[model samples]
Target chain A: MADRREPLHLIKSRRDSALATLVSGVPYLAWLGIRFDRRGDELTAILPYDEKLIGNPLLPAIHGGVTAAFLEVTAIIELAWAGLWEEMESGRIVPDAAVDSAMPRLPKTIDFTVDYLRSGLPRDAYARARIVRSGRRYASVQVEAWQDNRARLLAQATGHFLMPQG
Target chain B: MPQGPDLTDRDQTRIAQQFIEAIPHARALGMRVDALGEGTATISMPWAEHLVGDPRSGVVHGGVVSALMDTCCGAAVMSHPAGPASTATIDLRIDYMRAARQGQRITATAECYHMTRTVAFVRAIALDEDDGNPVAAATGAFTVEG
Candidate 1:
């Protein structure tokens, strides 16, 4: 139990650190008041509607890139929360810590499919993600973005995290 | 190859620089074309305080990466002598590999895998020089419109 708790604690600390880093490091997201909330296997983020995110000159909708970014971060953080970071740090196993020495080896996205469910209104929007499958060398996740109560976008992504070479 | 003047080294460099200059945010982000030739271009954006998402402490913004990917893909598409000068992204998918820490300059290498008269397919990976590993990877399809 203690051993399990240690890993969990380490993961929580890492997640906290990541959240802090995200909120502070990315200015445009901070400008939009994007915030993250986590619970067990699920992660969610909120982005306040802003005129700057608008793309279309007529309807003034949140840009698709904005939505995609929100989903991407949420999925990555969710994976981190699942102790994937710890698995990466145990260097005897996974060795590539390229992005950050602190971050563990994780898969790179090989493919992603996103669908625009509805036009994101000129108001605050929310996104949530859950791991659909986490295997030895791959993972799939589903994400959705919502404006108010309406589902505005849906996405599914598959990634191939390179396993340590023997 | 179709009959046309092949872009010289100077032509490619000028085209890349012009594309960078055209994007207001890219200019503000201090994006520069370090190299451009054939079907590839390497671009850089120096991290600045204003580019920070949280101004309280300087951390680069996520939107910066998105904008960078957008611009890099466009440049990559145009790097092809036959590709369009202007193109619209049909869809772009970016995977965040890691958080770019404070004061970390980011670099992107974009390449056009394939191109047709009306469409271009591009992919790129961005890294924080401080980390050396990819911070984001993106693939996009751009439609050239007359």
Candidate 2:
């Protein structure tokens, strides 16, 4: 299957547009201004700094809920991207046709746990999610968010989602 | 505003109201404190189209529920009898019982059930008209900033 796949750049561009469509489908993501950076199959969610995202003016810290929302968005998108890859590789859907069609329904979040390691500074934040386990009925994802220094995580979370069935 | 002292219910309400106003995101979401006590708070936000998660379902996003619960939990800690000046989230766990119905106001109530020298514990529930059925529930640990 790897031998029959499209060239690297072609696949990258296809995934990029597909990811954009998926991200745009959710209204809350747009409201939060959460966007993704796709590097091959890997994705990094970016939250641009906005003054309105502040929860505490005294601490000048970004809202904890905003951070959680960002992390959850990252996990959902990553899972969607992973699922899309299967159909894309099998030629079940063409890049041109896929972009025009409505995106598949997103998995529902069953539960989420977040750990705030440090206060989020008033600056841009980045997050990446790892699919701890993706099964037919359930998926677990772990996400880490960082600002400025990648080594220092501002917050981290784990979420379980109920996957949509066929 | 002394630490480890009982704050009157009226004082708690004032502190919670001021804290909610200071939060830009909470203000953006139109969240307001409905009730406050020694170590508890209840806040509400009216449904808005922009807050919808899935257009097809018209259900509010899980993250929206989380945000409401988180803010309420923090307010509970802030109004605690111990009076920890301020608090920040250390960790939080949220379980979504169901999607919130559209066009309904959502309210979250939280309590600072426990406090230590450096941390406070909180639990909260979010509801939309149906008090018996919660939209979501949360448990969290918060820092007791002196």
Quote each prediction's TM-score: 0.55, 0.92
* C-alpha lDDT (0 to 100) for residue A35 of candidate 1: 83
Least accurate 10 contiguous residues by lDDT in model 2 chain B: B1-10
TM-score of chain B of 1: 0.84
Candidate 1: tens digits of C-alpha lDDT, residues A62-104 = 5555565566556555554465434434532332233444333
lDDT by residue for model 2 (A31-143), tens: 98899998878999999999989988877999999999889889988897899877776657653425445466788899999999999899999999999999999999999
Worst 10 residues of 1 chain A by lDDT: A157-166
| Candidate 1 per-residue C-alpha lDDT over B14-99 given as tens digits, one digit per residue, 9 for 90 to 100 | 67677566554456557898877566778888877655543434556455677677667767776676746556567677766776
What's model 2's lDDT at A141? 98
Query: After superposition, which runs of candidate 1 have C-alpha atoms over 4 Å from their true positions?
Result: A1-32, A36-44, A51-65, A77-125, A134-139, A146-166, B1-28, B35-39, B48-67, B83-85, B91-104, B127-138
In candidate 2, position A18 carries an lDDT of: 74
